[model samples]
Target: MIHLQFRKVHGNEGESEAPKRSAAARKSIGLKAKAERFASRNGSRSPGKSPKGRVPKRTARLESDRTSVASAIAGTRSTAPPRPRSKHFANAVRAYEAAIKLMHAEDFGRAIRSFEDLIAEHSEEPEIQERAKVLIHACEKKLHENER
Candidate 1:
């Protein structure tokens, strides 16, 4: 046989089927209530407000910002895209990338040869030529070390 204890929900108090909480939990809840009360008395707003139906202040500012930015961009629109540094830069870049790929695949001899070809053919693009020269040295060093 089992027995149960029932507490009455007195005058203005409508109780539900929730279990009793511990002292620490109740104390923390009371502190939160006090914080809300203090925040209300001051000019500060309480946190975790419902955003339903009310347009936030930032929405207005952001809309204005969007219109202004759209107008400014329209005022400064251009017809043609920007040009590259040089005409042969694309070919040089392609060759350099292929050489680097060969070096990564451990074909250092072939990589060295490819980089040398890039350096010879793309002398107008000095930056790519310089990088190819550097990679050539690296490939040579790696190749000789592996041969030993």
Candidate 2:
């Protein structure tokens, strides 16, 4: 009776049932287990294991590429062209001349203030920068003498 029941069960098998899972699914499951184990051992989401828990070679290569792009952007920003000066050379020269005139008239305070304004306005000019420094020293000397 048991053999007859086994024959009856085996006789009704059909070809249209769900197909068995392919080898790829089994490999994927194995890979998933390996990935979980790797994540657990490293305490972080490291790509793969190395001798020192270093990132995988492919991930390191990507990191290097990102660094290179960052460096290139920085270089481009630094090498960008400077804008044209708003205050022309003639205007800066006139301002310097006016400050000198005020200094010669013994208005040391006003002259020093004008020189500071000129310096702030034309910081790119070497002559104005030097003159500003000299006028600052003169103003300091005059202030010291007036304090006596």
Candidate with best TM-score: 1
lDDT of 2: 0.80
With a 3 Å backbone cut-off (N, CA, C), the pairs that clash in candidate 2 are none
Segments of candidate 1 deviating more than 4 angstroms: 1-28, 34-45, 48-62, 77-80, 84-94, 140-148
Q: How does each model score on lDDT?
A: 0.82, 0.80
Error of 1 at 146 (Å): 5.6
Q: State residue 98's C-alpha deviation in candidate 2, in Å.
A: 0.6
Prediction 1 global C-alpha lDDT: 0.82
Report clash pairs, candidate 1.
none
Question: What TM-score, over all chains together, does every model reach?
Answer: 0.47, 0.40
Question: Candidate 2 on 1-148: residue-level lDDT in tens?
Answer: 4444755787646324535568999689788989889888987665554456454468888899999999989877755577675558778988999999998888898889989998888877987779788987898799889889
State how far residue 131 of model 2 sits from its true place (Å). 1.5
- Give model 1 RMSD, 1 decimal: 8.7
